[model samples]
Target: MRDYVDQLKEKRICSECVGEPYLQDQIEESGQEAECDYCNQTGRTFTIEDMASLVEVAFQQHYERTETQPDGFEYAMQREGIREWEREGEETIDVIGEAAQIDVQPATDVQEILADRYAERDPGAPREVEYEFEREARYTPKKHDDAEWHTKWRQFEHVLKTQTRFFSQEAADTLKEIFGSLDGLKTQAGRSVIIEVGPGTEFTAFYRARTFESDDTLQEALEAPERKLGPAPSSLSKDGRMNARGISVFYGSSDPIVALAEVRPPVGSKVLVGRFDVTRSLRLLDLSALQEVEAHGSLFDPAYVTQIKRAKFLDRLSRRITIPVMPNDEPFEYLATQAIADYLATEASPTLDGILFPSVQAGRGQSNVVLFYKAARVQAQDLPEGSRITASVASQWDDGLEPHYWVSEEVPETPKAKKADQYAHFFGWDEHNPVTQDNRDPSLKLDVQSLVVHHIAAVEFRTTPYSVDRSRIAMLTDEENRTGDVPDF
Candidate 1:
């Protein structure tokens, strides 16, 4: 008998041996039957190694028969250095023991096996998969009914973050033309600058007049003057246009100034005698006035009160000037009074390389003089014969004065182009002045020089508004009443 088998036989009696004090007492009394626990009373003997195998088999059977896993199954597997797995497609079990692999049949519980393996490795950590509902719920769609409120907020943010300093390249060019330099512009990195312009109207004029052989009406001439933006270059008059510099004077009204002054030739040059024409119209409008027109009226003839009101011309002129213009970024009002003050200061303390005039006022429909550092002039033959738009003659005035008329035409929207158009329109109107006659002989061919004004003394800005009185237009006929002094032309 194997030693282990003998030990087991001595420990317990066979089931077939009837009990007395115990199964051992029955075994002792009957001595006719010999039994072994390992063989189930077959009376077979086994080697020690065989007994150990039987013990393992008995324990495995107990583990399988239990409704739940044994409490120490994972611990015992780890202690014994054993690992269990199922064959890929079969019910047979493969066990990896300390030194070799063993096969056990019909133990194909993969999930349970994996659970045991995880439990052994992690002890008490969770073995089932978990999900976080709140984390995923964040991406769910939301509903809201206040769309207008949202839009308002969006607009607020847009203006705050993006609208402050952003403007188009064209806008910058226009601003530079006005300020005489881009160094005066304020901006942020990678952002363009927006210029908030004040509402006002500008009037411009030219000295010499021209007539085109093909066309007679002033429309072609009024529209023909090309805008000269930026500083006046030396080549400005290369094509035989008017070119002049130093200070220049401009009258604010549309009335013909030919009777007052004439463009005389250089001492030895040809006499440049031509008509005097003055064109006036609306210029830039403020932000508020840029909206759709409230009423439709005549685009010409300011004397027609309906047209003036419909276009909001007076309202735009009355708008307050509050935007910054200088390179120092200071807000300034372009009042005629302030302009005179600034001129005084500039003159009192002149800088060697600074602007000579130092300041110019952008008045609101006020009669004012412009100081041009450089301007050019040419004879009538070099330009087109401009068109003339005639309004009803102002006949309600005193009989001694000549009848007055308002000439209107479509001018460019820009300050510079509109000024150029105004200049071209009046080029030849001076010679045609009904009340004035040219002193020079009409047969002499003439060349002209630019109209020049030496100082602010040449400018005469009126504090009172332009006379809407047709009678006043006729009444103001005398030489002194028309233009105070001859501009240096």
Candidate 2:
């Protein structure tokens, strides 16, 4: 009888007896049938001894013993709060059931099994201790501290928009820290966010669009399309998503349609789109890559938790930076992004020439690129040193057909070379007009053959439509509406 009683305590528990999906699957694959001690019915199960490893792991990953607090007497003498004397953790049996999603009896049995197993190692140890299971406070597997980053970013935005725009030392320092942290962020696959653009690279060309309100404006642009279609000169530049007022930057797209969408031209307007070839190698930060940034490490590592939090924060920050802002709100809203552009272009280590971000106006997969002032300069068309040049346009059409337009540049005879004495009289004559036209660093060459003109007959908008519902309610009687009184339905 004594031997039988001892054997009953170690009876096997079937897979059906386990509640956790993973444990159930693990047991089903490896366990054999036996009479479950807790359920009292014969079923497939593992003995308590066989389940020890799994139980130990589950507790290690999800539970921590609650700390003991000072009693009321100690609190009065030590100046501790009322909470110090209050019970703090869930009951041990309740915790086991909740953590394993098991019934009360099974939880109680498991607790006894664990207690017995633990007692064997240290017979004199106390058994009155309680444990607390992690619920909402569980360590995130992805490891990003999104709340902290979000709070910091919002503070930065508020400071830039309301308190200071030009000379906020605090804001500058904060932005610098944020960017510095993002410098080496990598995707789970270990790919860097920095990308190269120029000859031989995938992103060798970009399309820019300019909308014209009238035929006259269109013709004017056709005459000097390269100059007109390129980035606006600093003086004529307006405040944009990535630039301040009077600060010029080339805003183009990998896809021409994306470029047109970005400009948001009105109906019945003409859009002149031109492709420009990147003239030299340049580095750009790829904002779209931020979505895949992740940190992978053991949950037990303290540093891994911080790493994952940063990764999650960066993923969210990418979208926040690229979200579309209405024209009316752009002045205040664009300050943060403009500041980012400035920092990446001028202050970042291994300085980037621009940023490549997803096009919010065109939806996902399509991207837009912004080249800072230094990398946005367009290379002028080469011409003879002493020759005068003129632009001409010819339009031809047959009956009931669309008119075809052609733009051509005509150059006259070159002027005779001046004598040595004549050149000596005007020293630094060549210096007066340097080789680089407009005194700007040239980085792009206009691709004349890729020029395209789009006539906008109508504008299309993609939107989510919601139905508005109206409800009517009768006024309540004074008796029924009495303060703190319940009304019968």
Candidate 3:
């Protein structure tokens, strides 16, 4: 039989600390040798007190690490020191046979015994509480569950990924399966029949959805409290800006060719062609319908398809530059020109030097293209003593006088005159005087006289938007005049 101290070492508690120091001393003083001749080993024989003390010490050490008692105390004790006494009918097994067999039952009822011993110990001992806690796991594949939004996003992605047209059979079937009410639309073939008013009365314009910067506008409109389903046409004005129908196109390119390629249609879609600027990110109109316009070109010709990728040497260097016209104010326009002038003064002037037929036009009127000249800077010190356009004097409108209102010199003598004020209010304009001068505000003053142009550079002319009809046509540049006449194709 192995002693309590030696047997405990074979278990996880390999340290020499075993119960009270006095109990260990008592076992050492007994001088009885515990030996197993078959295994050729000798060890001290432990008394009943020694065995109980060993269990108490082992329990506390285990609690220090885990903050709980050992899960199976009985099995632990049996493996360490305690042995079961043989019954009357049972024959003595060999040493190896006894070591091999594990009695399922514990040698002693350790739980009942340890309950009393642990209770006797001081409450505020070192091995009392566990400070470290196991953190909750983040992503466990087995714990994953799909959410409602996930399913919705997946359906949306499927449509976009497959490039499904709204009128396509697949799109119709999918929407019908999801909504149930759309099944009736299948017989309509996604087209509407229009009754003509006269000989030529028809939808002269293609009514496609206007693209917005974000979808929040549509959300707000749909959730409005007064909106109803399927109202009469008379209830809504023809030019209403309510945006009752939500339509959006997702393309960053302003080129008509690129927009057509993005839609991937069967060749008859209406296309919008216009540049995106600050006031309008997309100022396009669906005036032109797609048609089989003949392309005349030989792959070997140098002038053939000068648009970037089609060219051999220049390759991707071809570009269309868009400069937005400032509001019809002389001061602000001067400032904008200065910005462009300062840009040309830098090394990057070569890029913008290539702009051809850069002309100025009225924002809201059909006017002839004015020659946009590179202006010179004039300081206040360089002007004469008392010039009207000089910087020394301020404008007459800056006197800080409040605007005076009164009836016109000629009042309305008839029904139309009586409704003049109401008509003015309806049109959101002041009837007394439509124009007001408030130049005291610093924004109106001309801070600088001019912007200097640094150097001249080579520019390739492509097209010009004619001031007469507002139609863009192809042109070239030469020595006589920088902007040349349109080439005959």
Candidate 4:
């Protein structure tokens, strides 16, 4: 017979004798017919040895021994001179009863059984030491060494900013691994980051804004506003959050207000905003959706601990990619994101055309988009051959009323091709032609009716203020304070 059974030969626990519903059910289903010692009633019962095994398993999984404190005055002083201390844990019997939700008598009996077992292993060890539930420690998984992967990103950024901007093997390898891993990640809702967007989709249109300081510039833009407001040509292209110098990419927003805010127009300047329709289907990586990437599994699984750490790192990385960068820091701070954008556009599998990210200027409920050079081409309006077009803006105001501004387009009559000739040319022309005015394919069409002009009268700022505190200090030499001590010279 087991030692516990020999020690408690007269004690047997039944399902009805235990308070925990799960433990009660477990005993009732697997226990044998015997009289319960505690209740003094005949029913299904488990031997004391069997009950001790269950208690031991629970202790191993949920309890940890408290550490012993040092015997020193300094340590005691730090603890506020409280020298006499008990272990920071619950009573052994109370812990066992509460953990299994068993009645006091049965819990005490189980505690005695465990105490005897502990004594058998180490005869000189104390049997009264308290035990704490490993709640905090269990939740804090062992740290996985992710420093190598994290250092890769920092190294890549450093190389691009200081050493090599054009070609760096370290940057390329790091980006390849990152993109490869991200490509397989999915949102908690099981949606891929690469989403299809265009006509008849949730993201059907994008808005771009431009600011003008003078009437001449505004008028010049109105003449061919589609071309003027579109992505700038390589010669005029400047560095941006996701595009380096000489690299042109379309930067727009889902919300017109966000688009206007992004340009940061001066208080006295005029801003023109236009909506552009997504002409066809395109693939874009949505960075905001990365926040929902899930890392969930049973706590018992060792592999899940590493996954949780990686998921946390990914959450931080997603924030870093989209966080706003100040204007002065853009030159260096944008290198990492710019490199990511370039790689996704040219080298990523399935060929992404653009990226969608949260708008830092407008905060939540707004999103910003960037279409790479290949997908930034805007379609020009089709007009009759030799047709002359002119644009005019009119602003009128009545007394005590706000001024209203509007634009009008005028077209002059021109020669037209015959219907038969037009049809013949359209039908006979080859689908593939090398000759073209613009080498790139069009991906966006301007929605002329959605144009609006905003006159900036004031700028608003949101700020947090801190009060300044001041203190004064004075220094004196022995000579300056020698009223009674001149002998010291």
Candidate 5:
């Protein structure tokens, strides 16, 4: 048996000195451990005299990190230490939280990343441009595609456990019986709709209710909130014999991924599970959608099917080389290239590990085909200065002046414009003067140039909004150009 005294709050103290912050207990992002000479752990809120809590956590990790030990104290004694700390009369201050990492690169710059393709020598090559960030910003998974999103698989597992806690095993069993698959569970949904859990929402509540427990525990945990109950616990507890939190499983699947993203976790919960279904818009073997080759369905041959799969978009998704994509929109051709466009519009250059695309087009509702594009992971420093087309001179956009932005080199390799390199933005749109400098708005520029978009060589092709089939172009480096047509997205 364990005994403990009640928490007391005297005059407020600053937690920065004695420790005990909220962040102390929450697991840190992978590879990042919290460390503070004074605080027990980092916290976000500053509350009065709440510092007594540190003893509970420190009693374990303090010894482990310091001694570099292999094991921690036994649970029995660890409980005792917590009890002792609860009784200890000490004064500590309120805790404060430190800001998390931020991303400074702008979306526009990354989209304009130049490669080695050469053109008709409009300008030899694009020169480096100085960049400056006006402010500080960070990337959220919601904002861009992060392939390394979850460092540990357990992160997903824990969420399931939390939600399961909300329901009783009997309920889950009943649900399984009625729905047949977890994918089919529904709300008071009249016979056809499916239920979905939200992203980042915990399953603890569901699981707790499900686990076998003592009658008393069951009664206490399952007792409906008083507001819902009429007068007494007995009367209120049995609202048709069940109660759940934020679970509206009535919305069934047309696009399971989109439905999940929209109604999950019952609309109100922490960012517990980033649970979104993957929707896909599969590209059929026939590009024309009308052309047919083999007589009597010989098209099913593995070799023939393999050729179609090799198309740029499908191949990319198959390899997990996905980029940021507009989720659940109308179906479009070459879905993979769209993800790249999405990534360029949202994240900074080379910042994300990959992108995930959800489909909502014909034949691709709940099934998501993910593409993990690693292009963003490459840095300017990875290549020599002569070859650096996208690296910035400074690390931050707001880092003073001069080195404010990622630098783009002059394109002696392709521009005819006097100061061509000085004015180009993502996808070749000079944010400063997209009209005159980009050559897109012919009326604005002196030369009436036809701004034809193509992803070709360094001869000033300024390919805006163009995506090249990476492998196809790569093959061209060795394979003959054959028809001077680089198969671009």
Candidate 6:
């Protein structure tokens, strides 16, 4: 009767008459059935049981929610617009048609929501009544799964329509928190936004799987350092995760403006599950602590994020210098130098950001490197380390020999906190590295700046892999000598 038809999908509704207070008054003289004016308008009538059931349902629904719901959700449930809600109490209510449409401020907290409503309105105004509204369903006022899903989707839609840009899970979570607490979150239509995210594991969890438009601004933003998804799958095995999220535009033939959506990934696995410690995040990153780049806790780590950005920049501007495949008997160090020469001879490959190799080591293991040599092609012999991961930035970086190349250990780019939020201190093992000689270092004080390449003795090989640091664990295998580079590849 209040003309909420626009919000409804189907008109055939259940429950009692529209408003409260206007009930069938007993005719003392005739003792005949009478209908209230409000009931007549709704085209339906409700009994006391119906009213009780509705209120019970509404309160229960509003309780289990992590997101905000709409005022309309409690139409039949609220008596005199919540003038009659008292735990284990009784009261009656009046239903004013126009008054129902007026906007009401949502209660700030549970205490406020359960407080007494004693405003003196009309003499026959609604009053709180005690009614043991028995739960109809087997579950006592349990939230409907479909309804919960719809509520979250509605919140997502609201955000998408309001802002046209990428969104983060933290932003989504923050919005949900606000909706749950702030009354200003309610929109003109009487609905509120609330985000609910599940643990993301499958590809569907990521919204970018769907295609977007070719907007110039978007393209430029997407190309930015933060926008570009790096060469890796983002090994969130520890967090420090970074990715871009955008809204999906669905254009229909009829009305263009429709439901909105802010694409966001569900929450990922927690770092604690992976034995990660947040305390270690307090340290700065250097060669000694680079591999410890993986943040330890569930919190978003900002420092880990810095290293990720730096690595991406280096990888982007990095030039790939291909090293040749050395035979088994050859020393890999010399061949690594040869590949460096060949790397200098050829023009840089557009797609090849860096040269990765599966060099045949004298030992049972194999390794990879990026060389910058000019027509240098030969086998390796008596390389100090049986196999090593070394990198050389031709022309720009001059460290090793004549052409100037640096052969250092190939450490993984440090992973960061989920959304670049905090600093952590490490709390693993005894004080081992020189950077953290003092056991009193509260957080992980040592850090790793650049990786160093050191020769390995052949004895360390036996289908065995070792972790140079926590972030990078490596193993040498016979099959590694067969294929190379990417694990699956």
TM-score: which candidate is best? 2
lDDT of 3 by residue, 220-324 (tens): 222210111111122231211111122111112222233223223332222222222111111111101101111233222222222112121111111111233
* Steric clashes per prediction: 29, 9, 0, 0, 92, 55
Assess every candidate by TM-score: 0.17, 0.67, 0.14, 0.65, 0.14, 0.17
Q: Give the per-residue lDDT of model 4 (tens digit) for 1-489.
A: 366436684578888877666567767888899888888899988876687777666565435555555456647765895555544656677777776667877777776666666655665655454333222111111344446557777888889989998777788877876676556667798888778889888999999999999867777677667767878866677999889888878999998999999999999998989999999998998888766776654332335445655566666677899887888999999999999999988889878999999988888878999999889988876655544445555554555444444455544475566232222222222224444224677999988778888899998877789999998755456775775443332
| lDDT (Cα, tens digit) per residue for candidate 2, span 1-489 | 345434545766777777776667666777776677767777567776566445555555445555466565867956745334544557666766665666776665666656555555665656554322222112111212468767888998998988888878887787776677555778878878888999999899999999988777777777666668987876678989899988778999999999998889999887989999999998898998887887765333335555666677778888888998988999898999888888788888778899999999999889999999889978866644444434333344565545455665555476456423222112212434555224556889988778788888888888999999998876777876877465566
Better of 2 and 6 by lDDT: 2
- The parts of candidate 2 lying over 4 Å away from their true place are 1-144, 181-183, 296-303, 385-402, 415-440, 477-489
* lDDT by residue for model 5 (1-489), tens: 011111122212222332222222322211123332224454333222232232212212211111111134444555667522222211111001111110111111111111111122233434442111101211111111223222222232243344443334443332222212212211222221211222232110110002112333222212211111111122222111011221111111223223233322222221111112222211111111111111111121223222332222223333332232343421222232332333332342323222223223222323232212211111111222233243322343455544222225344454343333321232233546647342311100101011111111222222349666654335674434666777675
Q: Go through the candidates in order and give each one's C-alpha lDDT.
A: 0.27, 0.73, 0.25, 0.74, 0.24, 0.24
Q: TM-score of the candidate numbered 5? A: 0.14
Model 1 CA deviation exceeding 4 Å by range: 1-231, 234-293, 296-324, 327-489
Off by over 4 Å in 3: 1-143, 148-256, 263-272, 279-489
Worst 10 residues of 6 by lDDT: 269-278
Q: Over the stretch 294-413, how does candidate 6's per-residue lDDT look in tens digits?
A: 212111122323333333322221211122223452332232222222222232221111122222232112212221111111111212322334334234435633323333543335
Question: Candidate 1, 193: how far from true, in Å?
Answer: 28
